[model samples]
Target: MSLASLSEAIEQDPVVTRELLHEVARRSGFTVAPRHEAAYLLGLRSSYAIAKQVDLLPDYVDPRLSIVPTLGGSRKYSKPEPDRNGLSAWCHFLNLQAVKTETRLLENRSIALKDTIAVGYIPQTLGTLPHFISSKTEYPHSQIDATVVRRLLLAGATLKGTSICENFSLSPMSYTSIFGPVHNPWQRGFNSGGSSSGSAALVALRAARKAGIKGLDDLGPDVELAIGGDQAGSIRVPAAYCGITA
Candidate 1:
């Protein structure tokens, strides 16, 4: 294939040292004959680079171009309160309203995102040891909003903040989060389910409050809706445990 004509040199694979190739061959149980090795190494210098269209994508969303703090703008956030967050469902709380450039399809509705879904400036701990073990270099605040978060704000939903989730989203149950286990909103001390644990618990807590149930307390944080991630029963199991639709 023809390569683009350019003033600057096209990229080449300069790091393919003969020693490195020997190491690779040894590890892979393959033998590269010394006679053909030089020619084989020379062949790797070809590039897959292509010419770009001036209008690469007519109106592609370049996340980096968004210089603002977030679509929700700057907003103060609160930590999980012991009394207010008995279920350990939330990672942080905020009163972030949408920027509202489109139709207000989800106006006035509060939505919580799974911690794995990045929200610009909000700490994204993913319910792990990073919650306490952090420094300026290691603190895990998200620099950009996830694609779903951007759409939710454009649709006019208020962004409440990120919710707790299983550590690295590796657990099938809510008991593995570093923030602490997420309790079932219907019955405290019981599991609120899994990797999407926080999302399910928040929604259930809101529903339980509206139902005016006697046993459920009004102490926890609530949201009208929550966005969860699913891999296996991450979302489904949590919904099932809370007796609600996810």
Candidate 2:
């Protein structure tokens, strides 16, 4: 590629450029001497040129290609809105309008998903940093859905919302998240076990409704099922704490 083209690409993505520069400087213990600055820019230009040429190599492959077929139907996804509940169990609230399917196994079943799973037009925080959230114009919409989400849609599940999780699914206590602490359903002061805390809480709330308990949240819907990740005791611990079967 021409140097001008390379510069344009870098300029278009200042966020990526900043990160790349920081990483390179950190790893190399770079210092900005006047002579060295000129040499550094020249090296970066050369590297960009080489990378541009490498893109033409036949062996290279696009990493974002997916093997799964797209789900067909006139499905509608709502824009993400905030949760009013102090439970802090949700990251984004989206109601997906259901499409009629010949096979309706999970028809009318309200489901919530962990935020780590991608949903088109929904902000995916993964219960962590804001920087992880995609820019509004990054793409037309989410290009692909997570495999589990796709399967749920195919099975005629209504995706009610995306639930919160511990930041990067690292915490067991659910306290160290960017969304703030997730509280236990049974008690306000107690912690909801994580990282599947939100999923467990949603399920527990639905279960409570079935037991004739009322007025949990005016805005909250009855979540029949929740898709959560289980590395270590993420799913099991929260499920146990919330008195729900995982």
| Regions more than 4 Å wrong, model 2 | 1-83, 97-102, 132-141, 214-219
Per-residue C-alpha lDDT of model 1 across residues 1-246, encoded as one tens digit per residue: 233442122344445567867787889999889898877565443321222323353665576434234344575778877887878898889776655436688888899999988777777887777635366534487667677877777777888878889988888788999888999888889988889999999999989888886766745668889999998878888989888896
On lDDT, the leading prediction is 1
Model 1 misplaced regions, further than 4 Å: 1-15, 39-61, 64-73, 131-138
Overall lDDT per candidate, in order of appearance: 0.76, 0.71
TM-score of each: 0.78, 0.64
- What lDDT is reached at residue 2 by model 1? 33
Most accurate candidate by TM-score: 1
lDDT of 2 by residue, 19-114 (tens): 465577878897556556555655665576567668887773234322233244433444334446557787666666434443589888999998
- Evaluated at residue 150, the lDDT of candidate 2 is 65
Candidate 1 local Cα displacement, residue 201, angstroms? 0.4
